[model samples]
Target: MTEQNRLKQIIEAALLAAGKPLSLDEMIGLFAESEQPEKKRLREVLAELTEDYDGRGIEVTEVGSGFRIQVRAEFSPWVSKLWVERPPKYSRALLETLALIAYRQPITRGEIEDIRGVSVSTNIIKTLTEREWVRVVGHRDVPGKPALYATTKEFLDYFNLKSLNELPTLAEIRDLDSINRELELQDPDKVSDEQPDGDAKAAEGGEEDPETQQDGDDAIPTDEIDTESTVKESEAEAEPEVFAESSDETDSFDHLDSAETPSAEDDTSDQQIDVDTEPMDDAEQPETEPPAVALSDEEQTPLKTEIDE
Candidate 1:
């Protein structure tokens, strides 16, 4: 092969074998001192290789880290099938936190929390750092001296981005839902919060969102428990008052009957005593008289003579 073609072949082999991005300096270092090509010639070779890969399943990509060979995005679906293991899923919180770092570099944790309106978890920061997607650029000049974060070249490389300029503008984002769908991250938190695309389409056709169903499943029981407790409490409170009032009324009626009975007995006994002591008219006298009545006849005759006088 010609020397120029050999140089191109060498560069291509270096990129494919590296398994990661390589800068011009790194590529040049692979050659001997006498054989190293100039930076301009290297860039020209890289550009020519990029053109050659235009219609292929794989392409030469330039990322923030430098250049690398990667499968074109269109072929990833079929290519990914080669691996049985699925990609690791990240949480929506983690994704959003990463997004903030990428979009607003040199931002502090407190600043991210302020924009998100929720506190960022330490685990999420640790995860991003561990992945080498983010790093502490510097500390803010404040009392607490919070670390300012920025996106690393690994972040750009993973996302297949050339630079921060390649990111979609805020207006172009539309919503996180669309972005998440495009990324196909399938974050568990996002999945829990949003209905599936099929369910969403079904909802548009008059079915309910699955998320609402899940919420109902969780929320309805709580409402029912509260309602049942309130009803039972009200019933319990009403029952005692009803029983107490009935008992009080019954006791009052018994007291009234007892008091009236003694008064009635006393009145009847006084009436009998009055009848025994008062004199009885002749018409009211007994038809049969006792023997004592004859002894009293002489006394009665004097009493009768005095009555006639």
Candidate 2:
């Protein structure tokens, strides 16, 4: 292979092998400094690799982090079947919170709550943080100085976005519902189930609040409705064994109980014998009279007189 062709092949292999996105610096490190290709040449190879995978099952794409070879979104439905466990579904509230953070980054929790017109659940924040989608950028300069959140590179990678600029414009979103629809089109893999939870339902019911309502141009997109399956066949397969083990435990307990238990007649006879033995033992003990105390004659006389009175 020519030097250029060899470089392309190396870049393609690196991206394919990398489970996560690889930055330009990391890709450059693959080659010795003396023989390393220029940054521009590396990018050109990456671009060519991306084109080479066009119309193929897997495609090389660039995100905020860098380049990665991933299965295209169009084939995810069929590809996802390989895994037994379904992806996690996010509630509308959680998605809305993420949307607000993505568009109006470095925003505080309070700001998100204000935009949504409902108190943001700690769990939603926790889930986002756990997923590494959002991070603590800094604290707002107000009384509480609430922590501000911004989207991480992982968020872009998850959504297959190259940058924040790739996000849909505010004008495209008429309302929260419209926003969700657009998001669904953009990321079908992430969006699952349209049915909002109790919190989301409540938020929707109160969406008419003036403070929470926004103009057409500024309105944020709502979470898309997701209807993906959550069941894992692998988990279902193991359930029978778990039930069998549990039943075995129960049977062992029952057997132990049967072995330790005495018959009703035996218990009654034992109790009666113990009662009879107790009375006999008591009867065998001799009864003792109280000891008499001698008192002085004068004191006795006074006591007798007082008793008589």
Candidate 3:
């Protein structure tokens, strides 16, 4: 076979046997320094091998770390049966924390807490670190200098992502309200199905048929009816006391009204008296004599004699 064909076969065999992503440097290191193929030629061969696997059960793909041959996700159901062990199940909280770290790299734990609106559990961080999905990149240059975290290559490979840029945009990540609205729009039937029949009837504002109503009444237990009747009787017996209390309140309010009525009448009488006196005083003022009376001759003579003295 030609050298180009042989190179493709060799690369394919190495990827298959490695069972994990192999970096270009690792693949090139396989050959002697002098005999090593050019990086460009290796890439061309890798590309050819990827094309050859197209439409096949497996495919050659590049992840954040490097290249690997993995079974296509479409065939995973059938292929997964070959393994006796079950795949691990991750909690929603863990997945959310991981996504945040992946998208917002170099994020501090406090920052993640702020976004999630809860404290990050130590166990969650421990679990992700143990799984090799995340690692502490560095410390923030602030008070306490919290450690910053970033997604590792294993995280990308597991999610089938080539890089952080492959992640969904912030706009694409729907908020809880938008997600709930979308769910409501997508499958209204599902939401309806979850509701009880009585609630659905209430929502529709429809009355139950006579037969259904009779059936529901018949389904009530005898003891429940007795209890309900007893409650009604107790309420009826206590109603006289309630009415008596209310009557007492009414009597007190009537007393208050009676007490206030006299004062109001007194105020009206005072106002009326002032009004009557005002007109009488104006009318009498014109009839009353002036204080300046004409001086008698004897009084004038005494005043003149006093002035002369």
Task: Tell me the TM-score of each prediction against the true structure.
Answer: 0.57, 0.56, 0.57
Global lDDT of each candidate = 0.86, 0.84, 0.83
In model 3, the worst 10-residue window by lDDT is: 177-186
lDDT of 1: 0.86
Residue-level lDDT of model 3, residues 145-207, one tens digit each, is 899999899988888889888976544555533333422333455456657876877868666
User: After best superposition, candidate 1 residue 80: deviation in angstroms?
Assistant: 0.3
- Alpha-carbon RMSD, each predicted model: 12.8, 32.7, 21.0
Best by lDDT: 1
Error of 2 at 220 (Å): 48
Looking at model 3, residue 231 earns an lDDT score of 100
For residues 110-198, write the lDDT of model 2, one tens digit per residue.
Answer: 87777677899999999999999999999988898899999999999999999999987654554675445533433433343433465
**Candidate 3's TM-score:** 0.57
Q: Which regions of candidate 1 deviate over 4 angstroms?
A: 177-309
Off by over 4 Å in 2: 171-175, 178-309
Colliding pairs, model 1: none
